[model samples]
Target: MSDSNKTDFTNPSTFILVGIPGLEVAHVWISIPFCTMYTIVVLGNFIILFIVKTEPSLHMPMYYFLCMLAVTDLVLSTSTLPKMLSIYWFNSREINFSACLTQMHFIHCFSVMESGIFVAMAFDRYVAICHPLRHSTILTNHVVAKIGLALVLRGMMVILPFPFLASQWPYCRTNIIPHLYCEHMAVVNLACGDTRVSSYYGLFVVFCVRGLDVIFIAMSYTQILRAIFSLPTKDARLKALETCSSHLWAILSFYIPGLFSSLTHRFGHNVPLYFHVLIVSVYLLVPPMLNPIIYGVRTKQIQDRLLWLFTHKGI
Candidate 1:
């Protein structure tokens, strides 16, 4: 194609995203599943939040962390899924440059916040398991509130740099993000200017936030497992293991796919685009869908409260 026929890479207004060429069919395949998952994720998290708030028996440090987790799940899913579903169902894929950056900002912010929440929960679990004698003192309500504030502050400090760096780059070119959601890397890649700074900031934030959270979670689980085994009675061991199991499952499900997707984006972009879309969707959508189910089924208190709420409503 001649220069005149070539799409302008410098004119943000003229750039239209033709969305991964022939993969528009994927939109049809994705729409139903995404909508269903979003419904379940929102409803599930809301239920957990309600149960945690309403049930006096659940007003402990552990449930407090669980409530935070539910809030994070709600925010995280809300950030991306609505826009994605609109694109898939309505074929409205054109995103403004500023809007894209805004989406990217919230996506990173909530994601980092969720990671911070996970670390906080790990610490809570650690106190409860390893320092049971001092659990109440160590993880007092005041301390939990401080931890929540720290998580928000740390998440903002980690993720805000990406959007700042992104804003510096003039979107002299395409506005359409290839993926369903406005991912930081995807949006930055569309920038006509240098993205090295934005990319570096993104990497730094991911490593510092997600990486540290994963390590801390690992350490917490190590101590938790040791404590469980050290229990004299089988019933005691089983109970300890049971308490941590849901958390372990949640952490693994949240992090593993994200790590895989990051690795693939960094090292395996040479792979098929379809694979990229599939993996990204899985990473973004699966955790929210699974989180409520995992916690709901594993925590008996939440289950009982949910049942009570529904039964009362029916009456």
Candidate 2:
């Protein structure tokens, strides 16, 4: 009987996602803000893509990277938000095992892709500011396309192991994931077998992808700052620095919350489960919603384009 029960428990077909462990009563109220944010993320990123595509003048490597970032944000948020809303609104928490793994793949894959896009954007800024003469020659349309392809492949390869490993894990324990979506670690934790390999590999992926991305971005910006300061006039330096303002805001908005959510999940023992869930959820959704607004408000080109779009074309 005991053996049969264990066999039945191993690798159950479905997992139950407990939205916000302690805040179930408030899920309805909480979803209002989340829904609003998701709406903004979708519409804002779509508008960014549309504007970038329609305006010939905006057809540059930098804008290309921006469009990639916008698309990544769209995928990253869309992977988790709809199901989250379902969990909150309709009490639909059951997820098939394979479907959960798919969600886990996309949530992490696009996240890594977003980090890569930031690195690409940073490199674009570096080339534009530091080597203005070679900017066009260096990052031509072909090179930009290759970069996008490489980033997509890189993200897909790095995250491919996550779902495979999770599926292989002998899940003899309960399948109740105490959070919104199928977070990779949360799913892995249910395994009755050894999890050290998966856990360490997860850390390895984070370091290799996100940690290295941060390092590359920092290096690019260091050179960018050095180049800006070397300009002959204050106005020249200001002009060069101003071009990076939107990108800087986008980086800070995305990385800060991401870092916090990661740290709290791994190290914040005393933190409430509900709080952790909320932070992670917000981290995923807020940046996508904020990126377009930052660019539209801060980038003079985007601002002008938006104005032209609304006033002249009624878009």
Predicted model with the maximum TM-score:
2
Error of 2 at 17 (Å): 0.6
Worst 10 residues of 1 by lDDT: 11-20
- Model 2 clashing residue pairs (backbone): none
What is the C-alpha lDDT profile of model 2 across 50-95, one tens digit per residue?
9999889999999999999999999999999999999999999899
lDDT of 2 at 49: 97
- For candidate 2, the per-residue lDDT at 198 reads 84
| Cα error of candidate 1 at position 51, Å | 0.7
Q: Which ten residues in a row have the lowest lDDT in candidate 2?
A: 1-10
Give the Cα lDDT of each candidate.
Answer: 0.78, 0.91
What TM-score fits each model? 0.92, 0.96
lDDT of 1 by residue, 1-315 (tens): 234224464445422334444578887776777788888988888888888888889999888888887887778878877777777777776766667667777777877887878888888888888998999888889998999888888777777777677767766454555677777787678777668887777777668768888888888888888888999999999998888889889988988888888778767859887678668776777887788899999998888888887788882
| Model 1 TM-score (2 dp) | 0.92
